[model samples]
Target chain A: MEELLANPYVGPLVLTVAIILVFPLIVGYMVLAERKVLADLQVRLGPMRVGPYGVLQPLADALKLLLKEDIIPARADKWIFWLAPVLSVFTGLTALAVLPLSDRLYVADVNIGILFILAMSSIGALGLILGGWSANSKYSLMGSLRAAAQMVSYEVPLGFATVTAIMCAGTLSMQGVIDSQFERGVWGAFDNYGLMLIPTVLFIIAGTAETNRAPFDLPEAESELVAGFHTEYSGFRWSLFFLAEYAAIVVISALCVTLFFGGWLRPFPNVELLEIPFNTVFPAGLCLLIAFGCLKGVGKQVVPGFRFLMAAIAAAFLGAAGLFVLPLTNELVIGLFWFAFKLGVMVYLFIWYRGTFPRFRYDQLMDVGWKWLIPISMAGLVLNGAVQLLARG
Target chain B: MLIDQVLFYVLAVLILGSAVMTITRRNVVYSAVWLISTLVGVAGIFLLQGAEFLAGVQVIVYIGGIMVLFLFVIMLVPLEEEASQRRFSNQKWLALATGLAVLAMLAVIVVRGIGSLDHPGPAPPPGPASLTQNSEAVGRVLFTEYLLPFELASILLLVAIIGAIVMSKARRRQTES
Candidate 1:
C-alpha cells in the first residue's frame, strides 16, 4: 500500500486530477477578466450585478446555461452536431495535458511535447468545420468554412515560427526548450542576434489567428455570421463552445509563454548571485500585492454580502502569499506562481488585442497570413538555422 | 506489456473498422468523417508504437489539412443524386479481381520474409524506448543520408507548382482574348 502510494506517478496523477477539476474554473474567470478588462478599456462597467464587481458573474452564467433548454436543429446531423463541442473541448483540454506550467507541474512530459500540442490545436479546426457543416444552417456552414480556411492558412506560419524556436533550442520537448533557454542565459524570444524575435512576433500574430481572436476572427464576425458556427446551437451546447474557446485561448497563451518567454524560469535567472532573491522574492511580492489590492477593494464596496465575498477572496490571496513565503510551501507553490504569472501576462496581451483591433476582412486576413506572415516566418526559420550552425561551428 | 498489447489491438481494430466504413458509406460527408476516424486510429497505433513524432505528423498533415480538403470536395460534389447505387456493380467485380491479385502477391512476399526479418541481426541499437529522441534522430538521418532525395522532393514540388501556375495563366489569357 505504501509502495503504491509512494509511486512516482501518484503525485503527478493527483496534480493532473486537480488541474482537470480547476482548469474550467480558471478558464471561467478568464472570461470574466476579459469582459472586465475590455469594459474598462471601453469605459463601461462590466457585469456589476453579480457579486462584487461581478466577481460571481461566471458562476451565475454557468448556472443559467446549465438550466437552459438545449435545442438541436430538426434537420441537423445528430451525431456530428453533438460530437463537435465535445471534440473542441477535448482538443483544447488535451493540449493542457502536455504543456509545462512550471518545472514540475505538467500532466505529462511527452517526448515531442510541442509537436503534440500543435497537432492537437490544429485538429481543433476540424471541430469547427464539422460543427458548422452538421448544423444544417447556411450561416453555420459559411462560418465553419471561413474558420477552417483561416486556421489552415495561419498554421503554416505558426509551424515555421515554432521551427525557428526549435532550431534555436535544438530540442522539441517543451521542458527541454526552457532548459536550453536558461542554459544559454537568454529567452528564446531574444535569441540569435534578435533574429528569432521575428519568428516570435510571427508566432504571436499567427497564434491570435489560430485561436480566432479579434482582427482575425472573420469566422465568427457576429454581424456577418450571427454567432458563426454556433448560431444554431443553444444552451449547454453553446456554453460548451464558449468554454472551449476560452480554454483554447488559455492554452495558446500558455504555449506562447512556454515557447517564447521562459517557462517557469524567472527573468535573469542566469545571474547566479542575484538568482535566489530574484526567484524567491518576486513571487512572494507579487502575491502579497494582489492580496493587498483585493483587501483594498473590500473597503470600497457598498454591500455587506459582496464585501464578505471580497474579504474571502482577499484572504485566499493572502493565504497564497503566505504559501509562497513559507519554505516548504514556497518550493511547492512558486513554480505555479511563475507559470501563472507569465500566462496571465500573455492573456493580458490577448485581451489587449481584442480591445484594440477591429475585425479583419476575410481577404485581408488570408493575405496577411499567407502572403506576409508565412514568407517572413520562413525567412526567420532559415535565419535561425544559419545562426545556429555558425554559432556552433 | 499487457496494456500495450491491449491498446494495439483496440486501435488496430478501430483503424480497420473505420477504413471499411469509409469506403462502404453512401454519404460522402459520412465517408469523409469515417476517413478521419481511420486516420486518427492510425495515429493512435503510431503512438502505441512509441513513435510520438510520427503520430503527431500523421494527425497534423493527414487529418488536419488533408481531411479538411476532402470535406471541401465532398461538400462541392452533388452527392444527393448518387447517394444510393447498386451494391455489387459489374465493374466492382473486375476491380476486386485486380485488388486481390495485388494483395496475394504482397502477402506471399510478407509470408516468405517473416523468418528472415525476425533474426536479421543480433539486436538493434535503439528500440522504441530510445525513440524518445524521435525527431532528433529523424532529422539526423534526413539531413545526412537522405538529404539528396529530400531536396529533390522539394524541387519536384516547386516545379509542379510552376507548371500549374503557367497552365492556369495561359488559360486565363486565352479566355480574355
Candidate 2:
C-alpha cells in the first residue's frame, strides 16, 4: 500500500478517478446553486420539495434521467447521435486532467497545459456541431451552425486574452502560472499597473460567450432553437449533454481563476500578517457562518424529519468548519479552499449573468464578438507584452 | 518499453485506419469527421514523439479551426446527391497508375533516406532532457535560425486573409447590385 501510494503514476491515476467521480456531484450541486441564486434574484423560493431546500434535487434529477426512456429522432444519424454526447463529456472531463487544483493536488503537470485545455475545448465544440448536424431537425442544424460560428469567433479574443497571461507568466504549465503569480506577489489580473485587468475582463467576457451562457447564448436560445443542439436528445443522452455544459462551465471558471485570480494562492499571498487570517480564520468563519444559517433554518421546518435533516446538514457544516481549523488537515486543504472560493465566485458570476442579462440576438452577438471583444483583447495582449518586457529590463 | 511499443502500434493503426475511412466515406460530413480522427491520431503520434506543443497545435489548427470551417462549407453541399453519385471516377485506372508512381517515388526516397542515417533502429527514444525542453528548443530555433522563414509564413497568411476578404466583399457587392 505504501509502495502504491509512493508511486508517481498512482497518485495521478487516483486523482483522475476521484475527479471523474466527484466532478459530476460538484456540477449537480452547482446547478442547484444556480437555481437558488436565480430564484433569490427574482424573489422566490427556487426548489424546496426535495430534502429541505432541494439539496437532494440533483440526485433525483440524475436518477430520473437515468431511468427515463431514451429517445432518438427517427431521422437522426444513429451512430453520430450516439457518439456526440459521449464526445462532449469526454473532452470536458479530459480538460480537467491538467487543472492544478492545488500545489500538491493535480493529475499531471504537462508541459503544454493551457493549450491542452484550449484544444480539448475546441474538440468539445466539434461534439456540439456533430450533435446538431446529426439531429436532422432544422432547429438543431441552425443551433449548431450558430454554435460553430460563435465558438470560432469568440475563440479569437479568448486566445488573445490567454496569450497575455502566457506572456506574463512565461510558461505554459498550470502550476508554473500560479507559482509565477506567487513570486510576483500579485494576481495576474493585478499585474502591469492594472493593465492586465483588460485581458482579465476580456477573458471573462469571451469565456462566458465561449460557454454559450446568456446574452451570448444564441445557440441554445430556448424560445427560438428549442433547447439548441440537444433539442432531439432525451433521457440519459440529454443529461450527458447537460453534464457536458455544466462541466464546460466549471472548466472555464477554473481556467479564469487559475489564469487571472491565482489558482491556489490566497489573496496577498506574500503578506505575512494576512496569511494566518486568510488561511485559517476566514475559511473557518465562513463555514461556521453557513452552519449557523443552516441551524437557524431547522426551526422553520415543521416536519420532524425535515428539521432533523436540516440539523444534520448544519452539523456537517460545523464538522467542515472544525476540519478547516484542525492543524493537520488545515495545511492540506488551505490551497484547495482558496481555489474553490475563487472558482465559486466565477461560477456565481456566470449564474448572476444568466439572471441579470437578456439573451442577445444572433447578429448582435456576432457584432459584439467581432467588433468589440476581439480588438480590445488584441490591444490588451500587445500592451501587456510591452509592460512585461519593460518590467524585465 | 513494451507499453511504448504497444502504444506506437495502436496509434499507427488508428491513423492509417481513419485515413482510409476518411477517403472511403460516402457522406462528406462523415469524411470530415473521419479526417478529424486521423488528425487526432497524428497528434497522438506527435505526443508519442514528445512534441507536446506540436500535438496541441495540430489539434487546435487542423481539427479545431480548419475542420470546423470545412464542416460549415460541407453543410451547404447536398449530401443526398453526394452519396448517390458514383464512388469512383471514369479514370480510375489512370489515377491508380499515377498513385502507384507516386508511391514508388516515396519508397525510393525512404530507402535513400535510411541509407544516409548512421544508426537508426527508429532513432532511440528522446532523453528526458530533450522531452522537457521540446517547446523551448522549438521556440529558440524558430526565433533564431528560421526567423525570416517564420515571418514570411505569417506575412503569407496575412496576405491570404486580406485577399479572401477582398474577394468576399466584391462578390457581396455584385450580388447587391
Candidate 3:
C-alpha cells in the first residue's frame, strides 16, 4: 500500500481526482463572482444578505438546489429529459481531462487535445437540443432550435479560428501550442506582426457564441423563450444544466488563455531581465493581493459563522501566497499562478460581456455568424497561410 | 490486456444492441437517440483501436453535425402522423429472408476472416506511442502518397457547394423574371 502510494503516477492521479471534485465548487463560486460583478455594474449590492457581501451565496444556492424538488413534466420525455443534463455535465467535465492547466497539471496528455476538446464541446450541443425537444413545449422547441442553429453556424468560424492558431503553432497538442508560442516569444494572436489578430478576435466572438453567453444567448432569452431549452427543468436537474454551462464557460476561457494568452507563462517569459522578478515577485504578490481582498471582505461580513468561513478561505489563500515566497513552492506555484491569473481575466471578460451586451436577435445572430464571422475567419486563415509561406520563402 | 479485451467486447455488444434498438424504436426521436449511441459506440471502438483522431472526427462530424441535421429533419416530421403509421406490418417475407441471408453471409465472412487476421506476420503490435502518433503519421501519408485523391476530394466538395448555390440562385432568378 505504501509503495503504491509512493508511485509517481499516484500523485497526478490524486490531483486530477481533486480537480474533478473541486471543479463544481469553483464553478459555484464563479456564479457568486458573476453576481457580484454584474451587481456592481448595475449599481446594486447583489446578495448582500448572504454572509458578508454574498460570499456564502454559492453554498446557499447549492444547498437550496439540492433540497428543491426535481420535476419532470407530465408530457416530457422522461428518459431523454433525464439523459440531457447528464450528457451536458458529462461532455463539460470530460473536456477538462485534456486541458493543460500547467506544465505538471493535466489529466491526460492527448496528442489531439484541441480536436478532443472541440469534439466534446460539439457533443454538448446535443444536450441543449435534446433537453429543449424533450420538454415538448413550443417555447422550449423554438429556443432549442435557435440554440442549435446558433451553435452549428458559429462552430464554422470557431473551427477556422482554431485552425489559424494550429497553423501558427504547427502542432495540435495543447501543450505543444503553448511551447511553440513560448519558443517564438509571441502569443498566437501577436504572431507575424499581428497577422493573427483577426483570427484571435474571431475566436473570442465565436467562442462567446459557442458558450451561449450574452449577446449570442438567443436560445435562453427570457424576453422571448421564457428561459429557453431548460424552461421545463426544475430544481436539482435544472442546477445540473447550470453547472454544465458554467463548467463549459471555464473550459472555453481556459482554452482562450492557453491559445492566445500563453498557457502557464508569465509576462515576457523568455526575457532574462524580467524572468527573476516575474518568476518570484509576480506570483507571490498576486496571491497575497487575492488573500488581502478576501481578508478585507471578512471585515464587512455580518454573520459570525460566515465571517469565520471567509477567514478560513482567506488563510488558505494567505498560506498559498506564503508558499510562493519560498524557493521550492515558488517554482511549483508560478505555472499554476500565471495560468489561473490569465484564466481569471478571461472569466471576468465573460461576466463583463453578460453585464454590458444585449442578447442578439436570432436572425441577427445567424447573420453575424454566417455572413460576417465565417468569411472573416476564413480570410484570416488564408492570409496567415500566405504570410507564413511568404516569410518562409 | 484483460481489461482491454473486456472493454472491446462490451463496446461491440453495445454497438450491435444499439443498432437493433435504433431500427426497432417506435418513436423517431428515440430512434435518433439510439443511432447516436450506436455512433458513440463506434467511436469507442475507434478509440480502443488507437485511432484517436478518427474517433474524434466520428464524434464531431457524424454524431455532432450529421446527427443534429437528422434530428432537425425528424423534428419537422409530424409526430402524431408518424405514431399512427403501421410500424412492422409490411409482412414482406422476401425482405426479411434477404436480411437474414445477408446477416448469414456477413457471419460467414467474419468467421472465415478471423483466423487470417490474427497474424500480420512482420508487423509488431502497435503500442501506445504509435496510437498517439496516429494522426501525424496518417497526415504524412495522406499529403504525400494520396495527395491527388485528397485534392480531388476537396475540389469535388467545393464544386458541390457552388452547384447548390447556383441552383438556388437560378430558381430565384426565374421567380423574379
| lDDT-based ranking | 2, 3, 1
- lDDT (0-100) at residue A42 of candidate 1? 98
Between candidates 1 and 3, the DockQ winner:
1
**lDDT for residue A169 in candidate 2, whole number 0-100:** 85
DockQ of 3: 0.46
Tell me the whole-model lDDT of each prediction, alpha carbons only. 0.85, 0.90, 0.86
Please identify which of the two predictions, 1 or 3, would achieve the higher TM-score against the true structure: 1
Poorest stretch of ten by lDDT in candidate 2 chain A: A5-14
TM-score computed on alpha carbons, candidate 3: 0.93
TM-score of chain B of each: 0.79, 0.83, 0.75
Model 3 error, position A27 (Å): 0.8
lDDT of 2 by residue, A216-281 (tens): 888888998898988999999988998899888989999989999999999999999997789889
Off by over 4 Å in 1: B82-94, B116-131, B171-177
Q: Write the per-residue lDDT of candidate 1 for residues A179-256, one digit (tens) a residue.
A: 999999899899888888998999899999999999788878899899898889988988878878887888888778
Best to worst by DockQ, what's the order?
Answer: 2, 1, 3
Q: What is the C-alpha RMSD of each candidate to the true structure, in Å?
A: 2.5, 2.1, 2.8
lDDT tens digits, residues B11-45, model 1? 88998999999889887788888888899998998
